[model samples]
Every structure is written in C-alpha cells, then in structure tokens.
Target: MNGCRAKGSWVADEKDTVHYSGAAGGWGSVRGMTEVLARERPTPAALDTLRRQNKPGGFMCVSCAWGKPKHPHPFEFCENGAKATLWEMTSRRCTPEFFAQHTVTELRDWKDYDLEHQGRLTHPMRYDRATDKYVPCAWDEAFAAIGTELKRLDPKSTVFYASGRASLETSYLYALFARMYGHNNLPDSSNMCHETTSVALKKAIGSPVGTCVLEDLEKCDAIFFFGHNTGSNAPRLLHPLQEAVKRGVQIVTFNPIRETGLERFKNPQSPVEMLTGKETEISSLYLQVKAGGDIAAIMGMIKHVLSTEERRWREDKRHVLDVDFLAQHTTGFETVKAHAEQLSWEEIERESGLARADLEKAADVYIAAERTIFMYGMGLTQHVHGSDNLTTLVDLALLKGSIGREGAGISPIRGHSNVQGQRTVGISEKPELVPLDRMAEQFAFDPPRDTGLNTVDACEKIISGEVKAFIGLGGNFVRAIPEQVKMEQAWQSMRLTVQIATKLNRSHLINGEVAYLLPCLGRSERDMQVTGAQAVTMEDSLSCIHGSQGNGHPASDHLKSEVAIVCGMAKATLPPNPKARWDDWTADYGLIRDLIEESYPEMFADFNARVFTPGGFYKGNAARERIWKTESGKAEFTVPTSLSALGLGDKEGRWRLMTLRSNDQFNTTIYGYSDRLRGIEGTRDIVLMHPDDIAAAGLAEGQVVSLASDADDGEHRQVDGLTVTPYLLPRGCIGAYYPETNPLVPLWYHDEASKTPASKGVPVRIVT
Candidate 1:
C-alpha cells in the first residue's frame, strides 16, 4: 500500500495548504482554460467547441448537473465547463494499438489520471484471461459474448449500473433493455452522491427533486448554501449567485471548509471586471459549521425562527412561521417545532461549532427575507445521519413556507450532469420508481417486480459471488465506492463485467473472468445513427428536460451511441420479437422519447415538441404546487433531535475528516494536480487541519501522518502520508481530497436510511 504523498503526482517541495482561496473566477480561470486546452485539445477549433457548451441546440457540459437558465448569459460555460468540453473533445485517442502494447496488469498499475488522459476508447474490446490482456473484438462478437453471459446467469443475479452522464433517452432505453433481459437490478452513480437528497426530499416534500428552477435564483431574497463547494465542482452556479448578489440578495453559506468561491467571485464572463480586477462578494454570512454538524446548525436556525416568531406573535400578533401555509399544506409541524424548541442554545453552539451570536445573526437575515432558497450538496448528505441532515433542512424550508413559491425552495446541487435525470428515467433499484407494470403493458414484457440491489448492496452481492453479470453505463464505480481494496477483489469474482464508456478508466482495467469494453460516443461527439445525427434529451438539476445535440465529429468512427450499444446488446440477449422494436428506437432517439412519454404521460406529454423548446419544459414538482402526496396528503416535517445523529461529541484527540473535491477536478476525474483557489500549488496529498488541532495533536505544519478510522469495522481503515497544514477549518476537523481519502471511509460507515457513504465526518485518529 502506498501513502498518498508517495504517489507519482506528489512532490515534497510543494506547500501543504494555501492561506486563502483565490477569487472564484478571473485570470486563474483564463489560465485554467489555456492550460487544459493546450494540454489536451491544442487547436483553434476547440474554441468553437467550448462556445457551444450548454447552448440550447448544442451539447451540455459534461461536468455538473446545474441547469441552463431560460435566458442564459453570454459564455454559458464556466472554467471547468471549458475544460470538460475540451477534455472530451480532445485530439488524443486510445486505439487498438495502445491496448496491444500494454497488458491489463501493466495498465492497472498506471494512475487514474493517466488512464483517462490517454483519451477516447476507439473500439469494443474483450479481455483474454489467458493472455492477461484485452484484444479488439467485433461489435457482434462483443454483443454475443454479453448475450452468452446473460443466458448463463439467472437474470435476477445480473446487475446494471448507470452513470449520470447517460442521456435521458439512453437511460430509458437501458431500463427497458435490462427489464427485457429479465431483471431490474439497475444500480447507478446516484446511489453514491445524492441519494440522500432524493430519498429525504421525497419523504419531506413529496418530490424526489429540487422544488425550484433556475428562475428562483433570479428572484430569491436570500440563499442559504449548505455543504456544496460551488466554485470547484459547479462553477456555472456562481454566475447566478453573482447575479443574485447584484440584486441585493443576501447569501449565507454553511460548510466545513470555507470555500473561496463562496467568499468572492469575479465572473469570467464579465470582461470589464476581468480586466479591472473587481470581484463580487458572494456570502453575507459565512458560517464554518463543524463536519457532520449541519443538522445541528440547521436545527438551531429553526429553533431561533420559532422562538422569534412566538415572541413576535406575543408582541404584535404578527407571526413568522407561515402558520397558515403549515396548517393547510403540511403535516407534523408541531413535532418538528417541539424538537427545535427543546434543543438548548448551548447544545446547538457546541455541536455546530458556531457561536450562538453567529447562528442568531444568520437567523436574523433568514427571518427578515421574504423569500429564501436552500442549496446543499455532499457535505450535508455524506454523513452518518445524512438523510436526517437533509430532513432537517427540508423541515426548515417548510417551517418558513419557503417551498411551493417562486424564488424559494430546496435545491440539492447535484454532482454529475444528468444524475437526477438518470433516476427519473428509471435507473434506480427501487421497484416503485421503476414503473414495472406499465412497461409490461407498453413493451409487453414482465419486468422484475422485486426491488433490486443498489450500488452498496450490489458491491456486497458481487463480493459474495451472488451477482453473475455486472454492467456499467459510464462512471468509475469500482474506484468511487468505499473499501476499494475489497470492491476490486469482489468485482474480479464476477462471471462477466461490461463497461459502456467514452474513455479508458480504472474500472475497465479490473476485469472479471470475462469482461467487455463497449466504446460509446461522448456528449460532445456526434452520434450518427440510421436516422441521422441525433439529439438526445437530458434532465438537468432543475428537472428541465432539454435536447443535447452534439456538433463536433465523433472521437472515433467506430464508437457507437450509448443507445445503439444498448440496442445491440438487447437484440443479442433477448429472443428476436417484432414487438420489442429495439433497432427502430436505437435508429432514432425520438422514438425512445415517445415511449417515455407513453410511460410518464403526465410528466413527458408532448416530449419531442417541449424538449426542443429554448428553455426546456420543467417536469413540474408537486411539492412546489402545494400538492403533497404523503400518507396524509401533505408535506412532512421531520427532526431527528439527537446529537449522536448529528455526529457531535467524540473522544478528545479524534478529528473529523471530510473528503473534498479540488478546484481542478470534478467528482472522480482529475483535470490538474492543484486546487489553485485554495492556494495548493501542485499536489493532492495535503490534509487541511485547523491550526489549533495541529498543535493539540502534537503535530506541526507539513508533518506527514496517517489517519486511522475510529470505527471498528473489523478492518483497519487508514490513509497514509496525509501531510497536514494549517487551514481555515473548525477545530477538531480536517479535510482531505476525495477518492484519495475514499479508502479511509469504511464501507459499513454509511447513513442508515439512504445508505450514502459517510465520506464527510469520518472519525479518525491522526497517527504521526
């Protein structure tokens, strides 16, 4: 096992942590544009490709799931968007010759960044276990191999995994193909990132999505940002935040790590500000909440609002809790209010790691604002009580009657481009969301009726040799999950593993007894099918359904569209029937949408006409319309009301370790070695620690140490050589770059309800 600092990318000469984060956008963004393009895409034509990103008729950014505005500003793509578009539209290619030159073992030893940087996968390949290598295979041969594997296994034992990058049409067709092949084992990347956001919001709001659209950003009076680092992960969001700030909207940010993007942003889109070196302040009150303490922080705000409203009612007969909305549109308000009132200010301040005065000040702004929106990400959703964390946030939104109105609602900022859409289009393991009976009526196939394995459960089943076939549609699942050391071992035991991807990844390198890599066209690449160059539909974070048509040439002529790949595999696996019409749907994606409309008539009516419209149609959230679908047919208010649930109160020397994404990367993809805004110069090995904790742990700045998990999961989980440096973090808390720190996150350490990996708030002992 290698220490993080011992990796090829780490250099000891580099400083451990930067004192401050750079302004969100400016010359640094331009520098990122120049550097990433020069290294990967080196051509003037790349400029034209970047210009088309997120344009109504052009390709969507392959980075974040942030929605495109109805009236989008000029230069819709952000710094990371440019890099992602160019990275996908790169000139590099991973041809058959490259695989022939490197064995599976040899390529497995290469770094993740290097494997992806090698470029687009040019052809379908099957692993030759005898030769310890992969050889190019004909599309038919690959499809036949998959069919043979599917027939060999009990269809119930087979599992399907989807990444957020898959288009809505592709996702729908995939769901159909998997059911026709005889199982509903559809697990995906959403199981890892925002499952809590979906699961919790659904229970609370009757909608498994954000209640507001991009239009809300324009009119919101105040925004309470929770957990998500908008700058590095979804830079496009900063544009709207900047605009909101200009309109006098107050912003309050809550995160364990104080991201610079939330502090100040200079829109790279504004040339005047770019040249003048001016910046816009993003947060009016930035509270550095303790890792895993968001529940306490949010609960404290709820309590303050309740007390203020009660006091105000006593004084002037004017109320603040929107009692009228709560009485009519919600249930269980009394329970949540009682829970909020019970928590003492001392308990709130201690658990949240914030001064009582600071919490009250934030409450001041929140109470004063007529309309507010709450936006959060993994920081709040990747904890021991992650689902409860989201529940409390929803309760706050409901308490204020913030939801079901323009300029106010809950927005769980998604990590990937179409992850939400993937779930909506039936990529889940849930039996109800999958629309099983409706498919039988439409496609005339009896789909699996039982609930299937999710990502975490799928890993467990695979390890136990219960899962025979593992199929993936984008995403580095093998590495992204916790307990990678065991996951990779379990994955190798499967009878067959299949990857449908645009580029080479570590997951492809870890082959089963028989494995297949089916190269697919990326979002930026043209997918020429029997019909013509096709446009695919994707649902954004805001639930806006729009068309994404690629303008650039395919990375390689041999690459097939994801829909085509799914059809070929389906035709090979299932007995040929005139009724299925797999080929016809694959030939033209519009046919797939027509089927989707048939399945979800209320949501997708007039799908083709609406998806082509400029702004795309909102799928419409019932919660926003005050149309609740709970047991009582009303929105619910839930409060966990436990410090243990909030992950506070630990042993004296223990530190809460939070995994973070560098400004240079998105999710598992590494674009560069440094997080420039954070002042980190060249390495991802550094651990961000509060100065007080460094001294308390008998450690100094730049001291290399290992983090041993406090949880006794039978296995000792640890990440070595995590060089520590003083960072603007709460005391007893530390931050490490994600995926690198993923190993230390125990597989068993997950939210009980949502099963989301508790990547944040990992209790650890700093071993010097």
Candidate 2:
C-alpha cells in the first residue's frame, strides 16, 4: 500500500466534478459499443458471439448478474456486456513468443488493463524458476505437475477457488473432484460478493436463492434498490427498471452516491428513446445513505412501520399486520418488532446519515405498497456488518409482508453474471455438503461434511503459510482480495498455484514456486467436444437455470474448456475411481448435467431437456410457495440490531470510503480510464469527496492526496496520487474505485458472520 503507483495517463483539472445530466445510455452507450468494435475488430464469425447473449442458446455475459428478462430484446446484451463479450472475443492472441519475451518481473510492472488487453492465452504454460519466466507446456504436463504438488502436500491444506464466471458444469465437476481428492477446502467468488445475501435470506425466507424472477419486476408495486448501481455494473437491468418506471412502479433507492442509472435511463433498445433522446426517470425517491448505514435506514423504516401498524390495529379490530402469513410462516417476529420500536430516531439519523422525514417518506411508500421487491448489491453486503444489514432488510420486508409472495421478496442484484450460479452448482467453502449422504451413495465415496475456509480465511491461512497449494477455476484471486501486497506475497508461499483462465491477468504475472496457466475457452467461445459442440448451463440472479451455448468458434486451438481443464486436473490428482468417470464427463458436458441432476434431483430434474427450454426454469423456492423449511418449520427471524458499521470507530474526519466500479470496467478487469456516466474522463486517480470535507481537511479540488487506512496492523495501507474532487456526498463519506483502492483495505476487515470484506465501506484518513 505504501509503495503503490498509479499507472497510465490521468487528465483531470481542479474544476473537474461530477457532471452527469440526469440520463444514461443514449450516445454514451453507442460510443461504448463502437469503441470496442473499432479496437477489437472481431471477424464476422466472432461478431455473431453477441447474438446469443442473455437469450436461449447463448452464453451468459461474464459481467454482472442483473437477472435476465424473459423476453430478451434483439440486442439482449447491454453496454458492459458488450465490453465483456468483445474483450473475450478479441482477435489479439498471447502466443508463446509473447511469454518468451516477457519475464515475470517485467510483466508484473504492467497495468491490469494492458495485461488483459494483450488478448487470449493460446497455450498451456508452466513457470520456470531458473529464468523467472513462463514456458509453453502440454496440458498433461501441466496437470501432472499440479498433481505432484497435490500428492506432496496435505489435501486438507489445499484449496480450490472458483469464480462466478465459470459455467455450472465446471463448478459441479470441481466440487466432485475436490471431494474425490478428499479435501473440503473449496472457496469461490461468492465469499467475496453475495455470500451474506445467500446466508441471511435463507434464515428469513427459508431459501438460499432469490424468490423472484425477472418477471417479478413487472408486477411489483414498489421496488427498492439498496446499495446497487444498475446503470454501470448491470446495464441490462436499467431497461427493466425503465419499463417498471413506465408502469408507474414506485422505486426507492438507498446508496452512498447518486448513480446516474438510478436517476434516469434511456433504453437504447427503444427506437423512440434512441432517436428522440428521451429518458425514463428511474428512482421515485433516492436516499444517499452512508456506506454502512443500510441497517440504520432499515431499522428506521421498520420503526415507522411498526407504529403505523399499531395505530391501524387500534383503529380497526382487523390486524394491520399480515396475521395469517406471519403467524403461520414466520417465527420470532415480536422480538424483531420490539427491538425496532426501541430504536431512537436520533440514533437512526446519526448512523444512517438520513433525515427522519426522508426515512418516513420511504416508509410511507412501503406501507402503501401491496407488493414489494427488496433488492441490494455489494453496497450492503461488503460491510463489517454486512450480513446484519441484509438481515435487517429482511426484517423490514417481512414486517411489511413483502416476502413469500409473488412479486414480493428479498433479492440481491449480483455483480458477477454467473457468480450466483457457481454457488448453486456447489462451489462453496463453508458448505453444508447438504446432499453429502446422497453424494456418498451416488459417487461411491464418503464426501466431507465439515465446512471449510472462505475467501478471507483461505487468504489468512495462505499468509500464515498453512495453505500449501491453490487452484483458481477462473478469477483474479489475489488482485480482488484485501491487503493486496500481503496476499500477493502469500502466493510465493505456495508449493503450487494453478490459474484456469481465458486471458492473462495480474495473478498470472505474480508467481508461486511452481505455477501453471491452463488457458481455457472464453464464455463466448464454443466448447467443442466429442458429443458435438457442448452447451453449458448457468443460473442467473433470480435462480433461473438456463443453457448458454456459444454461437461462435473457439478463440484459440490450444484452449481447453473449463470442463476439460478441471477433468484433466481431477484425473491426474485423484486415485483410480471407476465410478467417477472423469473422461466421459469431459467428452460430453450433458453427462456432467446428468451427474448434477443426480446431486440436485428435485431442482434439476431432466436437466438437459428442461434447461434448453426458452427462458429456462426457475429453481423452486419454498419461500415463494409460502412453504417454510427452517429449523422451526417456519421462516425464523434473526434480529440484527448491531451498530458496528465499520472497523474504525465512529469518529469525525475518519472518512468512510466506499469502493465502487467505474463504467469502464467490470470487477478486476479495467476496460478504460474514463467513467462517462460520472463525467470522469482519462483518469481513475480522482477521489470523489464532499466539497466541504475538502476544505475542512485543508485540501483543494484536484489536489493529489494519499489515503492511509485506519487499520494500523503494523503494515502501512495507503493509495497514492488520488486527486480530490468536490462532489455531492455526505460528510465523512468518499468514493474510490476497486483494484486501485483494494490495497487500502486490511486483510482482517470483513463481516464476522459472512466473512465478506468490507470493501463497500472502509475507514481511512487522508494524508495530504
């Protein structure tokens, strides 16, 4: 953090400030598409890659999971989706010659944007210790080397990490392999993003998956978006919100920043909007809540609701609450009700950074609405009390009888397109191993029942030299985690590290004693195999299990699908097992789906036939059916009234920084230096701050400043050359971008319950 460097050109002046006019996706979106079209210059065959995006017989975009519309438009994809597709299907190739010229040390200095832009990796490569470079190797050789390391180390200490971008088939096979190899150490992207939502929602609604589908947006009387930026991260979602606005659905938002997408959106799909430049107003009410102030806002809303219910109950003999629904389907409501009533208005206002009147206004809308959909994103989940915040939101949803009904439930707008799918198909570190008995019966072995490490725990063990080897299915592992340098150094402690990815990321540049880059097929590229060109399955944000078939040919001849790569690793690593036919699964992906059906028979019955159906089938949620399946045979409420919003104490000037993504990028991949939505151009070094705070801190607009995190854990945590820009933000609140601000977050900073890093809100002090 101390020696951090800003890469690339940065053009910002003192007069620079947030200047997005109240509209999104007109010419800006058009410009985004053309920029990639001109730069990538994909062949006519590759251009067809986007034809199948978000539609039946198409591959899922490796971007955000805003859920998919049942009736996908002709241009099913969005701006960010276009970028991801073009980036993946780019003509640029990273040949063996490229690796021959660049050493690990030299490539390490290149920025993330430059590294990935070099293009698809065309061959399997292994690290050469002598030359400190990667040399081309055969797939078998790579798998054998990883197998040798696995055999040399304890399976308990070896962890397998999977990204959400990986197909469901790959995740299923990975879990099967991990169990076959006799290790429960499986951690994936879920631990970093929406683990809190999954864990908390299950307790409240008796389901781990979201209860609503894309169709729910059409019917919901009121839609509340908490801690999400739909316009940038999940662009396709804006279209749905725009439609909802047209239908007069009351949309309320709670976020730290006034995202342009939440303000207004013009659907590029609409000819009238595109031609006339007409925009749809999105949020009916937008509350700029503090980063970790979600729980307070939720509590205040509940407090108001409870009072209204009491008054209504007195006015009429009939109950104001949904007496039948609550009494039959839920437990511990009175306890939550009591706690919310006791919450002082002053405390809620101070913690949430919201006026009580505004909170009351939102509450009034909630009380008036008969059906509501509560949706949230990383803004609420990536906090010290992330799980608690989610739980509190659930409490409000339940109090208003918002859950366990059509068009009324708690949902999370997943950032990664297939991230939630990874979890559904069994990529979990702290897994219940729910079907362990069934798995043992079917796979002919005793699967591990104990829960294993998550993202935070796995990294900690790696830092402590406990984890011997690590394999990532597909993700920028070390780059996305907290304490960037410390975690990067942790890679060197490993005996083996394997990155199964399409492109060369920063993780590939950083090396372990021995490393392997098993180049895999991109999502947009067809995974041709023995059983014809295979189509993989993916679950969208709303738990719709759909088939994603690549409409285009392979990016590189040397590339293997994630299914093939995983099968190869498993065959090399595991002892002979006749029951587990790794070869057959690799040859035919439908066989993988057959095995998945065997694992989750009820949810994925006739997996092959059903997944191919038009919009795919929704995995049945008991909550949506009003059937509770919790410990009490009812959806039990767990009260969360904790005030622990951040790691650093509630002190003035100790600004709460919320890490966000620019429109130019998705996750760790940097697409460009500009965020056109926020009017930021040619620079990512600018930190958005309140105009008053800039003067109070003795700092001027566009003045470059250093940020030192308050987590004083002996190691210095600071981001360099961040130019301060005045903006409309709450006092003691600021905004920073991901990967750049990743170093400022301490390793220990995460929710104790969910273990998700407090990336959305970290306490830091500006060192001018």
Candidate 3:
C-alpha cells in the first residue's frame, strides 16, 4: 500500500470537491466528450469514426450492450462511447522498445491508469525471464510456444477467458478451439457480472437473455430502474429515457444512492435542450434502499400488491392479478402470494430501509401501468443471494403479468458490447448450456462435456496451482477480478499465458513464466482478412444481431484480428482434423457465419444474409413468445425464503459497501480523472458516504481513512488512503469505485447460485 502505486494506493488531491447536483447529459457531456477527443484522438478521421458508430455497416460501440435504434440518428454515439473509441484508437503505442526500458517488477508499482495510458500495443512480445522484460517475438513463434505448453499440460488445467469486447465471429472460433483442445474451461466477464441474470432468468422465465427490444422501452407505460445507473454505464440510453419521461411514462428508481442520471437528464444529442438548458426530469418516484436490500425492497412491493389484490377480491371478486396470464402462462402463484403474506412490515422496513407507504406507492404505479419493464444492473446481481434477488424481481413481474409481451419484460443491463452475444455463441462454462452434440457433429471431434470453472473458481485454482495456463481474449483479467493481492501473485506462477488484446494493461505486465502478448485489432480498427475487409456481428442486451465493420486504420501492421489470433492458436495447438477448416474460415468470414448457422440453426439461420440487414435482426427469445423452455415448460415463481439481501447481517460500526463506476470510467478502464456528474475531479480513490454516517464516524470531509472487511474469513482484507466525501445515500450504505475497492471483497463471498462476487455488498468498517 505504501511503495506500490498499484490497486491499493490512493492519492489525495486538493482539486477534488463534491457538488453532486447536475443533470447527467447536456453541455457537460459535450464538454467531457470534447476533452477526451482533443487529448486522445483529435482528428477528422476520429470524428468520422464517431459518426459511423452504431450505424448500419459501421463498427459497434465498444462501450455498453445497449441496442441501436431501428433508424439511428446521425450521431448515435454518447460520451462513454466516445471515450471507448479514443481509448482504443489512441495514437500512443506500447512497443517492445518501451517494454525493454521497464522491468516487470518496476512496472508493477505503476498505477493501472498509467499502464493502459501507454496506449495500444504495437507488436507481439514474449516475457523474457532473464531480462525481466518483454522482448519482441514473432507471432508464429509465440503461438508455437503457447501450443507446446498447452500440449504439455492437461486441458482442464487451462482457462480460456474472454471479455465482452469480442465479436460473435471471434467468440465462436474461440469456443470451437477450446473444445477441440479437450476442455470447456471457458470463463468470461459474464461470470463476474451478469451470470446471476443468466442463472435466475433461465430458471424463472426459460431464457437467460432479456425479452425486451429497444422498441419495448418506447411502448412501456412504466420503467422500473432497480440498482441500475444508466448515465455512466449506457449514456445513449438516456435519450430513450428522456423521451419516455416526455411521453408521461412513470420512471421508478430503487437504489441506495441518488444517481443524477436516474433523476434528470438533458439529451446531449438534442441541440434545443442543450441550448435552452431544458432538462427532462426522470424517475417520478425515487426510493433510496439500503445496499443489498434490493430483495427486501422488491418483496415489499410484492407484499403490497398481494394485500391489495386480496382486499379487492374480498370486496367484489375483482382481481388485481392477471388471472388468465397467471393460470395459463405461469405456475406457483400461491407460493409467491403465501410468501408475501407471511412477511412482516417491520422486517421488510428494517432490511429494505424503505417505508411501507413508499412501497405501496410504487406498487400502485406498477398496478396502473398496462406495460412495465423491470430492469436491473450489477447492484442486485452481485450479492450472496444475487440469484434470489433476481428471481424475486421476476416474482414481482409475474405477479402483475408484466412479461412475455411487448413493452413488458425483464432487462438485465449488461456492461460490455458483446457480452450477451458471447454466451449465446457458447462461450459458457456450463456443459448443459452449450450445444455439445451439435458442436461435435460440426467439428467431427468428441467434445468435452464436463462443467468448466467460472471466474471465481478459475482464480482459486490458479492460486492453488491447479490451473497452469491462462488465455484472455480481450480484458484486464488480473486487474478486474476480486482478491487483487492474491490473484496477481498467483497469475505469475502459470506455465503459459496468452493475452490477445488491443492495448497494454496491468494483466499483460503481470506475466506468466512463459507469457505471450499478442496485439489485436480494436473494434474501431479495420480487420482485413484474406477476403477483403471483414464484418463481424455482435448481439446486444436486446438480443439483436447486427453487423459491425471497422473503418479506421490499424494501430500497427503487426496487429491481427481476434478471429485470426484464435485461428492461429487453434492451428498451433490442435492436431490435424480434416473437418476443421481453420484457414478457410479465417480467410472468408462468411464461412464462419455459415458454420455458426449450422451450429445453432434456431438462432443463427441465414446468418450471413440476415446480418447485413439494416439494424440487424432479433435472435428471438422463447420467453418473449410465451414459450417456456424450462423443466416445467412454464414460467415458475421462485420464493426466496431469506429476507437478508446479502447474508451479511448488520454489524455495529460496519457499513455495507457497494462498488460502482465513475462517469469517466467503464468497467475497469479509466478514461480520465473527472467524474463531472458527481462533481469530483482529479482522482478515483475517494469513498462516498452519507453526511450522517460521516458525522457518526467522527470523520470530516476529505478525511483520509481505511476500510477493513468484516468477514469471518481468515484473511484480513482492506483498502487504505481513501478520502471521505459526503453524498446523499442510505445511512449505513457507503460507496467506492470498483477494482480500487476490490480487495475488500473476498473471492469466496459470492452469490450462492451464480458464484458471482458480492461486490455490491461487502460488509466493511471505516478505520482511521
């Protein structure tokens, strides 16, 4: 914490101030985007890239998984999208010469921001143990070395990790190559983020992906925002929400802290709004629930609805519930009704930190709206009972029959651009979730049927020396995961690590004994194959599959496409198989698309032709069609017995810590030091606490403090040197930016079902 400026260290800045009262988007957003463009990519070419983003035949935005409109505006990109583009298309390069100047040990002390700020990686490099640096290496040589190491170790001992940045074509090849190598150890960013959504939704509604399309939001009478901050995560979505508010749609928000984006937003894309300073107020009702209290809060809403329906039924036999939809399309209504009736108001109030009257008000809105969309983010999913929290949300939706139709369905707001697509194309660890038989028939090889490890499991195995090899598609793997201290050290002990990325990150610096750093084309860069320029497809959160063709110049001549990199690794590792046409597939992406159609005929039929269709085509969800694919063949109501949102009970002097992203950042990638929406600038190492909590702890504004986890686990986890800033939130709930505060969350403290790290509800105490 002292010497190294890595994850744990924090720097105090006099310029940092808290004045958190402003609309999310407007001139401020324009200014932020302009600043990034000026610093990173201030050129006509960069502006052109922005114009084409999210447009037909243009590159997809590498930001969030929000879908594009049928007829998109000329400038569909948002501030976050602009930052992601410049971050990828930066002129700065991390060459072998630069790597030679700095040793791994020395580079470890540098901050995560500094490491990535070095810019796009320029060439293939291999770790040199003798020199303690990364030396230039040929792509062929690096792949051969990785293949030889893979041949030496068991396939189960290796982990094939993918970030959500990879396109559908690249992800398919990556998944194919791993199964050919004899294992399904395919762990990706989803395991850390939305695995709870996948697990819960699949059981409750029969499909993992969200049922609603972009148009559904427009058609909805009410939009419920549960633990989701749309501004920082998906800025372009603000335009839609702004329009919804104008249309008189009831926007109900339930979160521990008041996110400005959820409260009000001025459409940055709208010139009149920006010029006239007309901000559209969002969220007709804002309920600030305690951290990890989403389950209790949602259940409270259910309780109110159930009580009202019962009273109305007794009065005149009038039904508040959708009796027909419940009887025909779903089952287990009695279980949900009984569970709600059993819950006490005192217990719900204590757990949720919400009054009964407010819950009733929210329920009334839900009851009045003909169509409502239930949307949630990591806040509800990253808990001990994360799956239960989601299922409980599903129960509420089912109570009012707010699903299986247009404008009414569950939406899990995913982070990365193609995160949902990766899982759809079989980048999953679960053997049952993937089509092993079809894959075996297509490849003419026996596929591995054993369940693979997830992010948490993979890290534990890496620490225990069970996993020897690590292959990342595109992400800061070591830096993004929890238990930073242990995982970073354990990552170095692997036999071989191959990172296929667009830029330099802390993960590349924390090299394995025999590590190969292979630079690949970013989403904004041209990915030319043997068949001219290639167009890849990505599935957004709405399950729309669209074509994305990069139009910019490559960062370096040595850079290859992610598809090519995966094919190269496959050729180098797998034994000669007549059925596997890696070279042909790499040459013509249409062949890959054809094979994808052959593998998943139901979803990817006519993939090559339909992908080129304007605005892409929907991958059709069964749940959306009211066709349940679950074991029961019907939507099931799951009753979560536990009232504790996070199993961690209330402890004296301990605060429920929820990690979040700043307006300037997305996931683990830090764009700049300014969080303009929050009125903070210069640093991300500050902690957000309620004014009452700050005074109760005897802490003054800007006072430096440390946070230690209150887990019963043997390890003492803490983050030091955090500046205290007073923000309006629930009294016992505090907030800090993630990856910086990841150390406080233990790897084992995750959702019981999904194994997703409980990042939103780590019980910690502030220590001076």
Question: Backbone clashes in each candidate structure, one number apiece?
Answer: 0, 0, 0
User: Whose lDDT is greatest here?
Assistant: 3
lDDT of 1: 0.84
lDDT of each: 0.84, 0.83, 0.87
| Candidate 1 residue-wise lDDT at 552 | 78
Model 1, position 753: C-alpha lDDT score: 81
Please write out the lDDT profile of model 2 over residues 1-768, one tens digit for every residue: 211222233334313345565377887888877887777766565567777787876777778776766677998888889988888888889889999999989998888989988888999999998998889999889889888888888888888998888888998889889977877788888888888877777766668777887778888899999998888988888877888888889999998898889998988888898899888889999999987888889889988988888888888865556778778777899998878878899999988999999999999889988899998888988888888888788778777577877778888888777788778777776557357788888888888777788888899999999998889988999899999988887789788889998888998877778899999988787778887888888888888887888866677788998998999998998888888898899899888889889989988998988876777788788888878767788777667748546666667558888888988898998887768777677777878898778888899877899888877567788899898877777788899889889999898888867888889888888888
2 against 3, candidate with superior TM-score:
3
Which residue pairs in candidate 2 collide?
none
Model 3 ranges off by over 4 Å: 1-17, 42-44
